[model samples]
Target: MTPPIDHAPTTEARMLEIVFPDHTNHLGTLFGGTALAWMDKAAFIAASRYSRRTVVTARSEQVDFKLPIKQGQLVETIARVVEVGRTSMQVEVELIAEDLLSGDRELCTRGRFVMIALDSRGRPAQVQALPGSAS
Candidate 1:
């Protein structure tokens, strides 16, 4: 079962967006680029929150568009920090689409983002090590 959107555990971030006409493609579905952008933002937030430091996206991987989100639907992007290394974290992001009228929802997209924590001088800095990770 899917967890509630408002339930954010540690190392997790959740964001919601309404799909307007401007965010849609010519076919009236949410634009792929826009979805990716949102997913990246969520990943950034999760990584930053998990490490409590500045973080930057180093890579996005295995992005899969499972379903199309139509305009006027609501999109929830949930990001969680799943793995952490010395200075890098892997965030798993999922985009779920909900019909505003019927309250139906589906998982539309998913991706993994790698973020590197940065020091004040903009160099990679150590992040809090996960329990099983090599610090």
Candidate 2:
């Protein structure tokens, strides 16, 4: 028989979004809150895909914005599970901004989010650990 649904390693997550005028500030750069929302979405995708369960963000670590994302820049966010507990998982998220014209990319944001799995009753629930995780 095939292994169960939760018997696999987590698939890494990558999301891409373009910085538009609507998402920018008077300085013509992406707003900090918008960037953070993208990072949080990336983390949620990673966690939900891994556990295949309803997950919610418990907290996010200090976010660092290394570079600015200007209008028309492409932002790519990558997320991976770095740690796990009985009911929580820590996802490391990194956002990169690229100037498509020049093909230059820089790390723009970095943060770690703690996501908690929830049962049908909305209480903490155990998540199946990654196959080879030390947890």
Candidate 3:
């Protein structure tokens, strides 16, 4: 039998209107590096919410740019924690570009980020399991 879909409450974090200038790009659109930076920031928020401690990116599964974001568009990023390991968490981040006048929104990029919790001394730290998170 197929497993039930997880409808657990996802902690949503949003960043709005974080401008990216044209100089930070090789193409006219937003640079891939800039997208990655935003992804990291979003993932950090998700991971810290789940782990309740500082966390760092351990890996990026894949980042795919579905659409381009222009320099003048308003960018909004949302992150959600999807899974957790002993000391690591997986976060899904989606970047959307919104037109201020028309209120149109388009998904610009998406990726899964793996983050590991860190202690005060910067060592790997254990993260408490959320209810219904056990495998």
Best by TM-score: 1
Q: Candidate 1 or 3, higher lDDT? A: 1
Candidate ordering by TM-score (highest first): 1, 2, 3
Q: In order, how many clashes per candidate?
A: 0, 0, 0
Clashing pairs in 3: none
Candidate 2, overall lDDT?
0.90
Expressed as tens digits, the lDDT of each residue in 41-101 for candidate 1 is 9999999888889999999999999999999999999998999988999999999999989
- The list of candidate 3 runs beyond 4 A from truth reads 1-10, 18-27
Model 1 stretches with alpha carbons more than 4 Å out: 1-7, 131-135
What is the Cα-based TM-score of model 1? 0.90
- Candidate 2 lDDT, 65-108, residue by residue in tens: 88888999999999998888999999999999899999999998
Model 2 vs. true fold: TM: 0.89
Which 10-residue span in candidate 3 carries the lowest summed lDDT? 17-26
TM for every model, in the order presented, reads 0.90, 0.89, 0.84
The lDDT leader among the candidates is: 1
After superposition, the stretches of candidate 2 with alpha carbons farther than 4 Å from their true spots are: 1-9
